[model samples]
Target: MTSPSQILLVFPVGECGGAESVFMAIARHLDRSRFEPAAWFLRTGPLVEEVRTLGVNVFLHPITRLSDPVNFWRTVKAGRRLIIDAHIRLVLSSLGYGHLYGGIAAHQAGVDAVWWQHGIASPMNLIDQLAVSIPAKMIITSSRVAARAHVEVFGMNGIRLEVIHPGVEIAPDHPDRVASRQVVLDELGIQPGKVVIAAISRLQPGKGQDIFIRSASSALRRYPQVMFLLVGSEMFGMDRGYELRLKRLAVDLGIEDKIVFTGFRRDVPRLLEAIDIFVHPATAPESFGLSVVEAMAAGKPVIVTDVGGPRETVIDGQTGLIVQPNNEQQLSEAIETLLANAQLREQLGRSARDYAGAHFSQRTMIEKVEAALHSVLEADTATKAQRHEEGR
Candidate 1:
């Protein structure tokens, strides 16, 4: 039997976000016999703990700033040490900055790199493009839009790009959906049987929580029992002031009591179970709508902005509804329609869960990722052999 291929996965973010979660999921589920995975983060955070809990080897590297000369050298030194110590043949980078630093470090330490593009945006700098080009055997992206963006902006060849959509675990039916709803409602002191319209996302401007709040206010005038739930935290250095502004807006709209803010929840699946409708009104482009999928997995009818991966995930009028980005009227109308029709909501929710189960399971994601890694390694070896033969 062949020995396991050792890989060093590098992440640039300090906190656990969507990208960090995706890395953790892969590290947790990757085949141990075929691949030995290790993680290196720029700074220690909650994700470090999460990675370690999954039995993956985790290391911390102090990165003050990418632009600082002293920090850059330190980063290089750390990268070289980790690559050598871990016996890593491949370095997997999650974002652009991670790819840039990790690629240089892996090359210095003599290992191939694979840049995993999680965002819709392409690399902005020439060095970043070259770093990915020279050292990386392949590039893995999550969305077709991202792949197209890479080719259009950077002239990236199609051969180098591989699209792998992230997957989520479907939660089992909660035995205590009513009790769980009561627990959350009791904590918020909300009345029983209130219509809960929840936007379960990180409290950031790009997430369009402000628009959600405005829409909720409009919806509440027609249905006062409707309680708006904003269930997430501003952990990713996204505008903290946006959360404050949302609260102030709720107060100004005279619907502060109707709006509930639950910060940094650990029980998202359970929270999704409690929510009646899941609404995602992101103004910025989401490469993939993991939260929307998660909500669907939990058997909630979802409504998302008609952009990016949401369009791919949510089938309008079939699985869920898609509204124009930043259009509060459209968002409000969708929520009202779902709320008014229990039969339609049940039909869409069942369809959404079925679609999510078939398409976005964790097993599918792990298998696809394994295939991509093997393809890259095999191609790299063949190319090297060809070069050596040509030289001889």
Candidate 2:
């Protein structure tokens, strides 16, 4: 058997967020017989140490500011050297900034680059243009919405663009929902008989915590037995004190005590088991609704915004409800609809669990990613052979 090809995974930040989770999954679960993966983190944080435990050589080359041209080129050179020294055959980068850093290095070292777009479907800016300038072996997006938008923006023939949903683990055996719910409720001092609705994401402006709070306020006005849980804390210094703003908003709406802000809990699946409903109220479009999928996997019915990945993943009146982005009235109605009807909640949750298991399992994601990597190398070999034949 041939030796495993060395692959370098590049990331913009080494934090445990949605994108970082996908990065970790790949590093941990990739077939060791075929590929040996290493990681290069642009900024240091918690995940760097965790990645080291996976037996992957982790390199920290911090890029504190994106605008610093000197630092940018310096890290690119460092990464290129690593790529060359390690004999990296392929470089996989997360998001656009990572593409800029890793893509350029891969090009310098004469290897294939594959970029995973983990954000919304939006018009490409100058930086985005530069990031995509380095032709990739394949561009994998988290959702079809993202892939189509990127295919148009990158002006590709859609041959190299692929849609691979980021995966979440679906435990075959779940903790008793009643017990889990009581544990969370008891810990938080939330009384029994209250239906819990949760919105989980990093505490950032466009993530729509304010919107969720307002909807919760409206829903709670009619239904007194419902409690709102806003899970997650400010991550990567991106908060801009948005968490405080959300809290103040909750207070202003007179629903402060009705809501619980469970900032940054690692027990998301357990928390999902504790909640009756899930909401993803992103004001900006999401490339893939990872939390939404996680909730579904945990057998919780979700209410997600209509303009992005969540809309694609959730079926209205089937798996879950899809409200218009930033629409408080619609969101409030959806929340109240589920709160008022336990049968609908259970029905939607069952369907969502089935759909999530079929589509977004960790095994499915790793297998798809593995196949994509193989295809990239295969295409590269084929191209080299074709060139050799032409020369002959």
Best by lDDT: 2
lDDT of 1 by residue, 1-392 (tens): 99999988898876867777788888998899999999988877778888888888888886876669898778878888989988988889888778877888888987788888787764555545655554677888787877777677666654478888889998777577899888977777778888778888788888999999889888887787888889888885657687888899999999898888998887887778778899999998788878898888888899999769888888999999999999999999999898899899889999999999998887888899899888877877788899999999
Error of 2 at 339 (Å): 0.7
Q: Per-prediction TM-score, please?
A: 0.94, 0.96
Q: Which candidate's TM-score is highest?
A: 2
Please provide, for model 2 over 1-392, each residue's C-alpha lDDT reduced to its tens digit, 9 standing for 90 to 100.
89998989997897888999999999999999999999999999889999999999999999967788999899999999999999999999998889999999999999999999887545646667777777688889999988878877767744488899998898775556687779988988799888889999999978888989988888887897788899999988885788999999988988989999999988898788788999999988788889999999988889998867887789899999998997999999989899889999999999999999998999999999999999999999899999999999
